[model samples]
Target: MEEISILLLFDVLVGLTLVWLAWQTLSSLDLFRAIVLFIAFGLLMALAWVRLNAPDVALAEATIGAGLTGALFLSALAQLSASTKRKDEENKIENS
Candidate 1:
């Protein structure tokens, strides 16, 4: 009974965390923040899979869904930031 209650509490927290992370990922104005939230969402999803006794699925999610995707997002963000900086410099040069 105690074990069941603890599992139930863990389940509820995981659900809430998934919802919150999804909402934050959708609603964030900052691109970097949204990517971070998305990565967190993926990790929470992996945890949910682990709770369901699917370690293989959880491993896939952790590696492919979160790790690789987060790395991709970060890579894109760097390129975007660099381009934006270049554009801003061009604008400044034009104004001067």
Candidate 2:
């Protein structure tokens, strides 16, 4: 009974953290900060899955949800930054 109560408390805490992370990710003006927060949320979700005894879900979340998805987001962000830089350079060249 005591263990179950503790588990319940932990579950609630995890859920709250997840909610907070989601809110921060959505509301933040900085895209990079939002992406980092989202990645942290994914890792927390994996931990929650492990705690719930779902090893398969934990594994999938860690690899696919967190790892691959975060990589893809970061890559896209990099591409956007690069494109912006290229446009700036082109503008400077035209002006000169």
lDDT tens string, model 2, 22-88?
Answer: 9999999998998899899999999999988999999999899888999999999999999999999
- After best superposition, candidate 2 residue 17: deviation in angstroms? 0.4
TM-score computed on alpha carbons, candidate 1: 0.93
Which candidate gets the maximum TM-score versus the true structure?
Answer: 1
* Per-residue C-alpha lDDT of model 1 across residues 5-85, encoded as one tens digit per residue: 999999999999899999999999999999999999999999999999999999999999999999999999999999999
**Candidate with maximal lDDT:** 1
Off by over 4 Å in 1: none
Give TM per candidate: 0.93, 0.87
- Colliding pairs, model 1: none
Residue pairs in collision within model 2: none
Q: For each candidate in turn, give its C-alpha RMSD to the true structure in angstroms.
A: 1.0, 1.6
lDDT for model 2: 0.94
